[model samples]
Target chain A: MRSKASPVSDRSKGQAGWGLKSAAWFGVLYLNLPILFIILYGFTTDDASYSFPPPGLTTQWFAVTWARADFWEALWLSVQVAFASMLIAMVLGTFAAAAMYRFKFFGKEAVTLLILLPIALPGIVTGISLRSAFSLGDVPFSYFTIVLGHATFCIVVVYNNAIARLRRSSPALIEASMDLGADTFQTFRHVILPNLATALLAGGMLAFALSFDEIIVTTFTAGQQETLPIWMFGELSRPRQRPVTNVAAIFVMIITFVPILAAYYLTRDTDDVAGSGK
Target chain B: MTTTGAARPRSLSNSFSTFLYQRPRLVLALLLVPPLLWLGIIYLGSLFTLLAQSFFSIDDFTAQTIYEPTLATYARLFTATNLSIIFRTLAMASVVTVISGIIAFPLAYYIARFASGRMKALFYVAVMLPLWSNYLVRVYAWKLILAKEGAIHWSINSLGLGPVLDWILTLPVVEGSSLSTSYIGTTLTFVYIWLPFMVLPIQAALERVPRSLLEASSDLGARPNETFRKVIFPLAIPGIAAGSIFTFSLTLGDYIIPQLIGSSRPFIGQAVYQFQGTAGDIPMAAAFAMVPIVIMAIYLAIAKRLGAFDAL
Candidate 1:
């Protein structure tokens, strides 16, 4: 859609110099080298050290990680937290988007700012604030606290995607539904939901990915409870657990990678909406 | 789409929907209240509590927080050692933001202008994967890569550039036993971690730039460099600023990378964590936490003035 806007500029396409391409590749290498090393070390035969050019490769760590009860527990806890957070975010984010889209209100800018604050501010502030808030309220640090912490930021992810998609979708679709004598529930169920499905799915997946791998906020909110990232942190502190930690890192990468990829594809063609560009 | 039976009698849900339809204000309230209760009351209330806590002082003998408001904690924050931690974190955040912008620009430009169709999606996913990869693992990977007997050291030695690395490591402020123990290593890790945050926004902003604008620039007697300077660069500023917000604030508040990989000197985050966790001085930690908040508030104000939030 963009490239077709001006054919003259299209002539200049593919003219990116070798320097720029190599620079981009360098950026790619910079991003992935550490990740590659994580995978490499996961298969490393030596367990005690990160000696480069590992003496040999083996599958021992995978078996060891599989047998570890704590690893499984952490992974389960992370999954539950991510799912809960994502669900809360999806519900509240959708409501926020609907209100903002359908009505005019004073202090809307302030509300938007408030919504964005959790993510816009540093994680440390959110962590410590939530920690203090819970303690002051005499609330114990538990699964619920971690989910609450995760949901605050996760809401922003879903809200951004939902609002963007709402803006892209035409209001006429709802008007038409109403004109055809559909009630609010029917219009929402039949019209608004279909338009929002992919956006919500993408947002939910991103939210899950975020809550799954989150460490900083989890540190404050989780009391004696290990999420996968926190588990990885503990493992990193122990030299003997290096290989097993790397294997767990591989598990995290695969878990998050799938959702992120799904989100990318779900949102890639969002311009092609059911009632857009009308 | 499935059409409902028009002859069917209206159900309870339909009548309730009708009631809501007649009251748009009610509908709006219903839509807004839940999210507002969470964000406004819960999240903002917590923040307010933290700010209020910062104003209170801790008792030395009892090790308990005195409810009375005072600036003593803020005063404690300015002691020489504490001030150094503040400065160190600010310095690192600034440097990381700058370096991330430099490295992210060309790659973002390539993705924005050159890559198309499947290639574009591939590049986009490639950049995004690292961001979603476990944050702890990425930092730990860098720790291994920068360790004394790590991959970088081994590679440098294999290339017979061992002396060069050693020489580089021995430089004034950056000097340490190895890369992993220096500010340089921490800075590098910070850049790698935040690079994707910098790239994505720039790419989005650049993608939104209509090709016709570039055609107009070229047709208006502007050279390639002039067109880039006057048009492309100006359009990308919002994105760069937005990206800097993440890179700067994240680095400023992060305690983990420094804890695992850098010099033993504490950053603001480590200070906050330790003051609150080990020292059990909540007042001190709250006061220290305000440093990044204050810095970011100023940073965000400027970025907002530059229309960075639109890019975000």
Candidate 2:
């Protein structure tokens, strides 16, 4: 009987048997193959077309990408937009989360549904809606318009993280601080902020990454301004400079990957803290 | 509290904090108003404006939007050509969602159950890395890989499976000179891009299943497959529902993949782009944009009843 129970525990580990393991690995391979292929093709020497095995290999495309002024300008614009959107989203999302956590209100669920709408609905709807609104209001499309579009969705991400963290942190801690002679500002600064620090960090990094790689909404909102993804979209139509584009693709992979990795690490252990036992 | 300092005047910041603390309603209002205004006015207001524009008609002579509320644009939307674009996008989105859900389940199950500690973390990062990476680059990489003179072709030729590959391309629905020039390529790319969205939600759902229940089922003389059929799958449905929403809506609204990799027939997204841009028809474009909004609204309503948003 003891042996039977041991086999049951070992054999049906979480009820995911051996067959599913290989299937999962296959799925992982499918997810990553194109990304790996992009890195591989980035080193190809042939500038004109892509083939399975390259005819030659060279480091020249790096130099060409380095020398291109347009690439730098596009990269800088994306950085600025991402930074501005992240800042705005962090502030607004945290405030909204705090309010929701502290009080019961009429129509709160509807507000949540509305907050989720920008990301929940299709991007084309959001894009065209904003574009039409801008035209109707006689607002010229500029860098600010792009940030507005990106921040609409970015706020959702930060709000989800902040609200989740706020819910997990015991409300009693805030009350305790006030009882100990700390004023509202001091309670928030000393007790709430430290508890929220990691979740906000994770949320902000994710928002930044999403904003940095955003293209569809940016397409409608960015009148004359070019972000890196928009630049890549244009470059796609021209096939002669394929390797340089691949180099730029690799650059994008690195820029977005670092922040995402940092975010994963920052929030991975948070489940154990902030009154999570409930 | 500076006990050493004799009767000092309170600073403005302290007094303000005290006032705010005393008035909870004011604090709540302060925290809530800015975001509410941004979302309520700027976001939903724009959506309403787009919906309103769809009801108007365009003037042919001057190429301006007529302010008179009419259904002329929607009447045009019911034309056979326009209807084809809408149906084509619907079919593509449905197929992509089903395929992504199927492909994501086992992987999600494995990650949720089999992997642990560092291995679990590694699987998570593996699933998320491509999702967080550049969207256009992944699409472009697929373009290169599926081209006539590309990796798939080379690999098939090397494996002596060239004839098989050629035969698949000759099928009526997927017919093309190469994979890159077919709707098949566009479908494949959509599934690839949205697969992670499906995986994460399903994994989260599967993780929430209690291990003791499985043990109890096994102890009751039930076979593993029987236990799974009766218990595991029903639990994962909400996650699959949540994930399908993403894959379906994204495919419905995407213009770039079909434009870059597939047949020339315009999907709903491309038609919207064209009507708004070169065709100089805002009413028509807004009308086209309403297709996805209406479909997703219905879809989300069904999913919400199934508790899909909770998984999200």
Candidate 3:
């Protein structure tokens, strides 16, 4: 009578099924609540204090954020940085993956580690280091420095995606092209490029999304220059500008959100997404 | 295929392709050089430069960093205030990491083993969507949530849990600051910001666990609890470890959450920023920055030993 036995199933089917589902939903809700706040607050008629229930809903702040020249300038700077970083990342990342994947190389592991280092290390470390290098070398903080800082991590995104895609692709596809008397460049253009196109694009979109919203590294690299995030960070200190700031933040969310969504859809069929570690 | 009667217009491309084919090593070099130069010279070079700068000390009198090699700046990091900040930051990161791990594991397990294909994709998107949102505003939203007149306190009071919430708020390290102005607030914000980073890798790891093994354990008379402890936990440790890398490191390095939520106590990131930006003490900032670097290096090393790199 004192023996405790369990009617245990091997499948994790009925073990706290409803409880776990609700817990999972709770996790998702927890993750999105702040974002929901951003969206909600953006429409608030109140501009100063963040009341729990925003007094009223208005699209006035969106218009205000859009009308501000400063907002456009910051948005433009962010776009430039994101675009430049994505281009640099795509080219370098795709090439690095192709080279390392195709050829036998010495110190390959070291190379991989080096590529991963910027992202693997803390962003503040990268930020401070870039600042140090700039000051020492008499390099001014400019768009170039910002892009360079972004490219470090953005390249890794592309590299991870490309390498995973390359590894998964059949070597025989390239071999078939070569066997048919096609040259290396021709084979690559015909077989390899087609295979890697979506992955690299997905990677680039992800990289672009990252660069667009990057705050920590951009904070150090952008001197007297305000990217959208930098501008938003500045806005946080201004108490009167709460609605405007929320509106701008909402704008950024909607902008970067698209690329991220596109990147997800593009990589969904693939077994591994770069930063996703899947 | 026409042998000798190939189109004359394709000659340039054919020759170029042939030229590339004849020199595979040259092609490899061409492909490898540009990216290597960019990452190696620009990124790693900057890091080395930062490390070298950490050896220099700032002169308060001249307000310039002395170019001489000295560990004085590194030694400067041992002050009571700085050490307190470091300890607070480390404690916060540890708590956040543990909480995130606990919360994320079940959610990840559910997504991996239970969710349908459509549901899995939705969960993945949910996990990553927050990562793309503007980070600063997210912290600000938490500021509102934890404010005295905000949703949390309001709900707590309305739900008859006011005293309970107050008692918890008055507990150690968070006394008198209210929810919005305390380390509790900071830790909450950091955990919220970084929770997504905790979910994906763990989900991937759980997904990779073979179903046959679970059936095998059951067949061997092992209960679900025993199976989880003996098999699932050990295998999933690496994924948990990997997830922790992002949560730990991101929390360790973040300055914004502390600024927006916590009282005026400085964390490592804020200290570094203030030292460099406001105080013009680059060397001291560099030295302070090394705390996180050293911590993450050790963390990564341990994680690597645990096979977290495999998950990555």
Candidate 4:
């Protein structure tokens, strides 16, 4: 029985190794294929509708996308929303992080949980709740409400980054500054702010990217205002402007790719920062 | 400890220093106030109002009238059809979570264990690139692939196995034959969309497993399988839980994927969309929204019990 079990275990180990490799390759291809297709189709001049392998290749759609005013309007709206959301998220998240990190206050855990709750809950719930809240309060659904909704979730991203950074920073630095006769504002400016700079920037970048691509919450909050995602949604449902939808998607890809890549790098070094806390 | 004239000024400064050390509290409050108020007023406030709206009956199918309180919407939600919708949504979410977890584990393992600096960065970028793309565009891209004359069918036809394909295609359960707009498509899309969320957290958790632990296990004559099962898996469970919460909750609340791919069948998300958008029954929509919230609350409670919330 022992001999039989040993051989079976050996055989299973070999199978597991091969299985892991195959799965890894398959997973990589699955993720990359749609992105590759999107990039490839951007150059295709399929006027009627999009096909996987276009019969002809041309940059005409790119020209058409460039010349379109609606595209610009949607892109502008997206930028406005993203920027507004990021600003609000950074300020609120920074303060929240600072409060949670520095102070021993009542309801500190509850406050942190509340802040994180919006993110942990599905976007749909957030959207629905916001929609209901706006209607209940008789608040008009507009750009401001959209900004508010996006910022709710975006704050979580910023807070995660900020709090992580704050935890990593040594308390001795602040104590040293105080002993050296620096004021709170001076210490913040010279020490705390500089230490938090990379985290804040990374958080802001991630917030911007998230807000830029956000559709679910925007759908609930933006009554008439059309962000790029909303515009793309409308375009896709109505088949007349299918290629335009592809064009808008390509634009989204370009806008989001750089910042998201940077965020990944920023977060990849998470262990180093986390270790610093100890 | 001196309280004389010279010591008085030093004490005053000491008090000032203490005040300065804790000034972040006031700053935090000031910073947190606007966003917190925004959430309180716009998010939680709306949720309460929505719940209230659900109790009030719609009068004459026009402006919702608060004439009488009833549980009609809740009753409607419990109907066999709506129950099926709820079940389907939950089932799809479960499947997506499990499948994405399975697919993500190895990739995450590879990144965390085998890959180093540049390769890690490249792989990380590859994983997240899809997330940055327009959600609608990604759905539409799938539409192009899944359509009748799309890539899948084209590839099959081009291989000169057209007859064999046709025979398989003629099968009742084949996607083109009345099954295209089924749970399969919706589940596939959910898996694709939420895979990254699962990957990142699991990878992060796997990376946290101490190298010394693995070395110690191997030194003790434990094989790779034993090391992973005994040491790595336990540490990574919290991440797996976080990833599951993300994938499951997101898929549950998503109306767009099912609307785009799933046939005329209504998932909870689409039911809410219809209740609010098409049917104009805001109260019913709000009630439907609670389905996912309840599920998530339960999930969070469980996750908290498992210490997953700390990792977040």
Using TM-score as the measure, the top candidate is: 1
Going through the candidates in order, the fraction of native interface contacts each one reproduces equals 0.80, 0.74, 0.70, 0.52
What would the per-residue lDDT of candidate 3 be over residues A1-278, giving only the tens digit for each residue? 21322233223444456878898998988898777777788888877776777788998887788889999999999999999999999999999998989888788888888888888787888998998899899999999999999988899999988998888877777777777877667787888888788899999998998899888999999888999989988888887868898888778888888888888778777654333332
Per-residue lDDT of A1-278 in model 4, one digit per residue for the tens?
76866654444333336777788768877776866666666677665555646787777777888898988999999999999999989998887787778777777777777887787777777888788778767889889999989988898889989988888778888888766766677788998998888889889989999999888889999989999999888877775645666777888988887787777666666556532555
Stretches of candidate 2 off by over 4 Å are A1-16, A274-276, B1-15
Candidate 4 per-residue lDDT, tens place, B1-312, comes to: 653433455566556655755776666676667757866766667667777777765655565655357887778778888889899888888889999999998988877776655877788777877765566667766666655556655776788876776666565533343223555667667888888889888888888886767778989999888988999888888888888988988898898888777667777888888888877778778778888988888988898777676555
Cα lDDT tens digits for candidate 3, B188-259: 888899998888889878878876698899899999889989988888888999999999998888887888
Interface DockQ per candidate: 0.72, 0.62, 0.51, 0.40
Q: Write out the backbone clash pairs for model 4.
A: A133-B46
TM-score of chain A of each: 0.95, 0.93, 0.90, 0.87
> Cα lDDT of all candidates, in order?
0.92, 0.89, 0.85, 0.77
Worst 10 residues of 2 chain B by lDDT: B1-10
lDDT of 2 by residue, B195-284 (tens): 999999999989888877888887898897888898888888899999988998889999988998998989999999999899989899
Rank order (by TM-score, best first): 1, 2, 3, 4
**What are the RMSD figures for all models against the true structure?**
2.3, 3.1, 5.0, 5.8
Candidate 3 chain B lowest-lDDT run of ten: B1-10
Kindly report the interface RMSD of candidate 4, rounded to 1 decimal. Answer: 4.1
What C-alpha lDDT, on a 0 to 100 scale, does residue A118 get in candidate 2?
91
Of the two candidates 2 and 4, the one with more favorable TM-score, higher being better, is: 2
| Candidate 3 lDDT | 0.85
Q: lDDT (0-100) at residue A118 of candidate 3? A: 86
Highest lDDT scorer:
1
| Residue range with the least summed lDDT across 10 consecutive positions in model 1 chain B | B1-10
**Which ranges of candidate 3 are over 4 A from the true structure?**
A1-16, A271-278, B1-12, B15-19
Least well predicted 10-residue stretch by lDDT in candidate 3 chain A: A1-10
